[model samples]
Target: MTFQYSRSFAHQLDEQDTLKEFRQWFHFPTNAVGEDQLYFCGNSLGLQPRTAKQALDAELEDWAKHGVEGHFHGKNPWFHYHKFLTQHSAEIVGAREHEVVVMNQLTVNLHLLMVSFYRPTASRYKIIMEAGAFPSDMYAIESQVKFHGFEYDKAVIELKPRDGEHTLRNADILDAIEQHKDELALVFFSGVQYYTGQLFNIKQITEKAHSVGAIAGFDLAHAAGMLTYNCTIGM
Candidate 1:
């Protein structure tokens, strides 16, 4: 199949897209001369939603009106603020509502989850992860390993692509899991590589990890809104 390759063709497709109206819900940045710029950085810092200003204004109004009472008396009470996001967030990530929770930033959440999942033992204490993971993930794993009284060099296994290659092969990843099964305590990886844009086979990786008696986890910073997966499944 061939796709039309022209600005007019692209515009025509966009006009017919059912999600086209959603674009107006976000506030896009402008250039130096005040022309609307085409932004594509949603993979990192997403553009602010147009409704955000109204939401923030309402919060400010509540603070001014209720002061100490604002925690429980407002359009959206602060005490249960995160609850409003649970269902929508679960839908976005294809997870059950109970399986998801609104939390702090990505790295902070990773660290929090790691605290519960990354249990390292004297005999089975190794962590397997991609070599070129985001610095935050690498840092989190390194700190966890060190805190567990294990040296980073000995306890962390970084899987790399073959020489002259840019991405990890699925077979290589599975083979590494099997090869290091005995000492593996955790298998952590990214849903999508940050730099290379390679989407890993998450389900397979998770299964491989489980087969080896290891806990499987992923840093979904680059994957959350960009990819879809069935969280009800093992992955």
Candidate 2:
């Protein structure tokens, strides 16, 4: 069979997509010459929505109009500001409102999550991750393990793809989990591998981790908005 994914076909697909309206909400940037540039790096920094300026203006107006009172009295009170984003974020992550909190930046969030979830005892004190996880995640895990007084070699396990393979197979991952069942404390993986764009079998991996008495979590920067996966449902 021949593949049909040309620009015209993609535009046609966009025409029929239910989320077509959302495209209008974003402010896709153009090149210096005024041509719309292909933007495939939303995984890093997303395109700003056209309404962002207006939103910022509203916040500035609040600050100007209310000063310190803006914390409680402004149109968008800073006191409850994060709460406004919480419900939408919870829905996106497939979590209960109480289970989700939007506070810091991505790596900061990862570190905070690890503080609660990566509790390592003498016996089960190892954190397992994919070999080529994002640099920020790698740093967070490494520092957390070292901070807990465990040697890097003993505290962190990196799972590599088999020889000649560009992506990991589900069996290989599960096998690794089985091999380290007794020593594993947490299994953390990117929801989608950033470089290869391979989506891990998060639910299955999480199930195996739980079966072996390990906590499981994911860094979802690449996967969010691209596809829907439910962590709560998987749990």
Give Cα-based local distance difference scores for all models. Answer: 0.88, 0.86
List, in order, the clash count of every candidate structure. 0, 0
Measured against the true structure, the TM-scores of the candidates, in listed sequence, are 0.91, 0.89
Writing each residue's lDDT as its tens digit, candidate 1 over 1-235 gives: 2578989888888988999989999988999999878897876688999999998999999999999799999898888888999998888788889888887888888888888988888899999899989998899899999989999999999999999998999999999999999999999988889888899889999999999999999877788778788644322
Instruction: Kindly report which residue stretches of model 1 are placed more than 4 angstroms away from their true locations once superposed.
Output: 1-5, 231-235
Can you write out model 2's per-residue Cα lDDT over 17-85, one digit (the tens) per residue?
A: 997888778888899999877888876788999989999999999999999999999788999888998
**Best lDDT among the predictions, by candidate number:** 1
Location of the lowest summed lDDT over 10 successive residues in candidate 2: 226-235
- In angstroms, give how far residue 75 of model 1 lies from its true place: 0.9
Q: Which stretches of candidate 2 lie over 4 Å from their true place?
A: 1-11, 230-235
